[model samples]
Target: MNSSDAVDIATDALVVIAKISAPFLLVVLAIGLIVGLMQSVTQLQEPTLSFVPKLIGAAVVIALAGPWMLDELVGFAHELYQRTPQLLEG
Candidate 1:
């Protein structure tokens, strides 16, 4: 395929990746921020304190959103596969 087709495929793939990971990333970010604030206020600078909550939050988010993420990924893969013939001919 030409440059534009390649770019389009790359863009689609990136979008799918971002969409799939966003929930986990956002949950982790929120947890980290909250834990950081708590640490600052309480003067408890234990590294593992922050890690555990963020880990749990990420796991919870993933458990809750896993099916939706899978669906999005599957849809993207299906679309890409469907476009393979056109991409090949280009």
Candidate 2:
């Protein structure tokens, strides 16, 4: 309820966001790098070439780790909910 509590909640939210997004971002980054390298070697500059792989990589990451990400978010929400009474009383 106070500034410190708000800061703590904000920090926790940011951590959860980073944790959930890391996999997808990393996968996309790696895929994009590889695609870029391939394009450089092949001397082909096609926009879709880079776009498709990154998209697929992100989709695959979501498909594989979606449940875990959802669990993380749900856990954070549950924790925040549990702390509601304490926060409100402050």
Q: Please, what are the lDDT tens digits per residue for candidate 2 over residues 1-90? A: 899999999999999999999998899889988988998999999978888788889889999999999999999999999999999999
TM-score of each: 0.94, 0.96
Superposed by TM-score, candidate 2 places the C-alpha of residue 82 at a distance from the truth, in angstroms, of 0.4
Screening candidate 2 with a backbone cut-off below 3 angstroms (N, C-alpha, C), the clashing residue pairs are none
Per-residue lDDT over 14-63 for candidate 1, one digit per residue giving the tens place of the 0 to 100 score: 99999888898899999999999999999999988988898899889888
Off by over 4 Å in 1: none
Quantify all predictions' global Cα lDDT against the true fold. Answer: 0.91, 0.94
TM-score computed on alpha carbons, candidate 1: 0.94
